[model samples]
Structures are given as C-alpha cells and as structure tokens.
Target: MSRQTSQKIAFALLTAAAVVVVVPIVLVIIYITIQGIGAINWEFLTAMPRNGMREGGILPAIVGTVVLTFGTAIVSIPLAIGAAIYLAEYARDTWLTRLIRLAIINLAGIPSVVYGLFGLGFFVLFLHLGTSLIAGSLTLGLMTLPIVISTAEEAIISVPQSFRVVSISLGGTRWQTIRHQVLPQALPGILTGIILGLERAAGETAPILFTVAAFYLPRLPRSPFDQSMALPYHLYVISTQVPGMSTEVQYGTALVLLALVLSMNVVAAILRSRFRRKRRW
Candidate 1:
C-alpha cells in the first residue's frame, strides 16, 4: 500500500475510535436529560422526598452530596498537594519513596467497595466517627488521594527544570523557589486534578454506602457527624430497594449527580485555561 493510503487508513481508524468512545457518553447524557427533565421542577428540587421516595424533591440528598463533596475536597486537596510536592520535588530516589509511589499506584487500583469497607472499619468503628459525613468524606478523600497526588506530582514535575535552577541561582530558597515559581506554573494541573478527584468522590456510591449514606433521610444534616442521604445512594435505593419507585425521580437524581460532576469538570477546564494563559513556560 502507498504511504498516503496507509496514513489515511490510520487517521480514519483513530477518528472512528474517538467517535465510538464519545457517542455513548453523549447518548447517555441525552437520554438522562430527557427522562429527568420532567422531574426537575422547583418543588422537586427544593422539597423533601415523600411517599417512600416516590414523590416530592431530593433536597436533603442534594445538600448532603454537596456538603460531602466539599468536605472531601477540604480533606484531600492539602494532603494530596503536599504529598505530591514532596514526591515530585523534594523526595530523593530512595526505597521509601519508591515504596510510597508503589502504594499510591496500588491504592488507585483497589476497588471502591474495599475503600468503603476500610472506612466502615477504620473511620466509623475504630475512630468512632460513626456513619456520618465526616467518615464518608474521609473515605472518599482517601480513595481520591492517589489520583490527585499522581496528577499533581506529574504537574509539578512538568515544570521546566531550568525554572527551578534559575530561581535557585537568583538566591531564592528551595521553598521560596517552589512557592513563587514552580507552584504557579503547576497550579492549573493541580487544580484540574483536585477537581477531577472531587468529581469522582461526588459520584461514588461505594465509599459513601458504608460510611455515611442514610437509606431514607429526608432532612438536611445539621453537622458533619450526622448521617445524611447522598444522591448516589439515594438513587440506588429508589431504583433497586424500593418496590415501586418513580422512574422520573430515579433519572432526575442521576441527572443531578451527572450535572454536579460535569460542573466540576467545567470549573476545572476554566481554571486550567486561565492558569495556562498566565504561565510563562
């Protein structure tokens, strides 16, 4: 075959693969939106569930999911960024560091249900946090840490080595150099990772299932130590556990969860674009 023909064939194959990957996601979103749009009125969004979750709104679940997502971000972002900085910039090529990296990789590979079990055992039982928002947030945070750390570390490492060298040569301390030069450039990627991690944490059912999800709570949680309903678990219960749940309600809950994750992604994209524009190298 001619080189030109081979290149065209390869390009066409790649395009087809891309379309295959994207089409389903687009279809799913469209289907959910269509199914759920009828159920997304003000009363449905603002009121509490009634009639065994077949009527009314999902305010408590919405609030709980938002609060848990925020809590997860609070718990994970600082720790993940610090660990990433250490691993990417300060840590030497030692066995301990290697082991840490390996652990992170393994953590990322572990199933979500395992994290839920750990949360139930460690956070809920051992730490005496009980089945509450804090416990679930911690569980989700732990589950999300590996992703954020891996992405942030790569972002930090991607900063040009010459930038660090120049900062040091200009009489800047190590910490100062990183604070002023390295972090600014890496901020976009770090923010992207943090948002992505939070997005997953927001959507996950398993981590919250054991730690925090209330089977039928209708009120907003008063504190982090209180059991609350989250969208994922709420949707799961209505879809499977309830004998005669409304299809509209189930799809509406899924739509809300999807919207929440997509909103985080949009924010990440915006932040990444703005910061990349500001970056000098």
Candidate 2:
C-alpha cells in the first residue's frame, strides 16, 4: 500500500479505538445522571440518612470520604515523595534498589481486597487501631504509595541533569539543590500522581470496608479513632445489603461518588496545566 493510504488506515484505526474507549464512559455518565438527578437536592446532600438509610441524605458518608481522603493524602504524599527522591537521586543501581523497585511494582499489582485484608491484620488488629478513620487512612496510604512513588520517581528523573549540575557547581548541597531546583519542576507531576491516588482512595470500598466503613452510621465521626460511613461502602450496603432500598437513593449515591472523583480530577488537571505553563525550561 502507498504510505498515504497506510497513514489514513492508521488514523482511522486510532479514531475507532478512541470511540471504543470513550463511548462506554459517556454512556455510563448519561445513565447515572438520568437515574440519579431526581434524587439529588439540597436536603439529600446536607442531611443525615434516616430510617435505615431509606430516607434523608448521605452527609456523614460524604464527610467521612472527604476526611479519609485527606488523611490518606497527608500520610502518603510525604512518604511517597521521600521514597521517590531516594530512589531517583540517591540510590545507586544495586541489588537493594532493584529489590525495592520490584517490591513497589508488586505492591501496585496487589488487589484492593488484599490491601483490605492486610490493613485488617496490621493496622486494625496488630496495631490495635480498631477499624477507625486512622487505620483506614493508613491502609489506603500504603495502597496508594506505589502509585505515588512510581510517578514521582519518573517525574524527578525527568528533570534535566543540567539543573542539578548548575546547583551543585554553585556550592549548593544535594538537599538544597533538590529542594530549590528539582522539586519545583517536578511538583506538577507529583501532584498528578497524588491526585490519582486520592481519587482511588476516595472511591475504594474494600480497603475501607475492613478498616473504617460503617454500615449505617449517620452521625459524623468526632475523631480519627471513630468509625464512619463512607460513600463507596454506603452505596454498596444500600444497593445490595439493604432490603427494599430505593433505586433513586442508590443511583444518587453513585452519582455523588462519580461527581466527587471527577471534581478532584478537574482540580488536578487545572493545577497541572498551570504548572506546565509556568515551566521555564
């Protein structure tokens, strides 16, 4: 075939692949919106669930998800960034480094349910955290660490070596050079990973199911030690476990969860764009 004809065929195939990926996503959003929009109102968002979650809203679940996600971020981001920096900048290629990378890769592939089991064992029972916000947050932090570390390592490694060389030539210490020059350039990519991790943590049912999720708690958690309702768990319970549950409520909960994740992604996209625009090199 002529090169132009081959190029046209490739373009057509690519467009078909894009449509195949996007159509399902669009259909899901449309279906959820149609099913859930009627149930979403001011009261549904702000009020506590009543009557075995058949009435009222999911305020506690929403609050719990937010708190849990924030806690996960707090616990995960610094550790991930530190590990990434060590791996990318300090750790020489050796057996130990290779082992660590292999471990991270393995962690990333582990099932979410397995993380839940590990959290139950280590954080809940062994540590005596007792299935609370703190235990759940720590579990999710661990679950997300691999993602953050891998993304951050790549981001840091992508920074041009000349920047580090210049900083070192000017008498800057290794830490100073990384803190002043490298980190700023890599922040956007690190944030991208963090955003993705947080989004996953927010929507995850399994990890929190064993660690923090309450079946019917309507009141807000007063402390990190307290058990609380989470959106994913709540949706799961109402949709499957609860008898005679309203379909509207189920769809509404799903819609809310979808919206929450999408909003986080939008914010991350905006930040990434702004940082990209600010890049000087």
For 1-281, candidate 1 gives per-residue lDDT tens digits of 99999999999999999999999999999999999888899998899999888889999999999999999999999999999999998999999999999999999999999999999999999999999999999999999999999999999999999999999999999999999999999999899889888999999999999999999988999988999999999988999999877788889989999998898898889888988887766
lDDT of residue 41 for candidate 1 = 91
Error of 1 at 254 (Å): 0.7
Return the TM-score for candidate 2, rounded to 2 decimals.
0.97
Candidate 2 lDDT tens digits, 1-281: 99999999999999999999999989999999999999999999999999999999999999999999999999999999999999999999999999999999999999999999999999999999998999999999999999999999999999999999999999999999999999999989899899989999999999999999999988999999999999999999999998999899999999999999999999999998898898878
Considering only N, C-alpha and C atoms within 3 Å, which residue pairs clash in candidate 1? none
Q: How far off is model 1, as Cα RMSD?
A: 0.9
**Would you give me the overall lDDT of model 2?**
0.95
Residue-level lDDT for 34 in candidate 2: 98
lDDT of 2 at 171: 100
Cα misplacement distance, residue 182 of candidate 2 (Å): 1.0
Worst 10 residues of 1 by lDDT: 272-281
After superposition, candidate 1 runs with Cα above 4 Å error: none
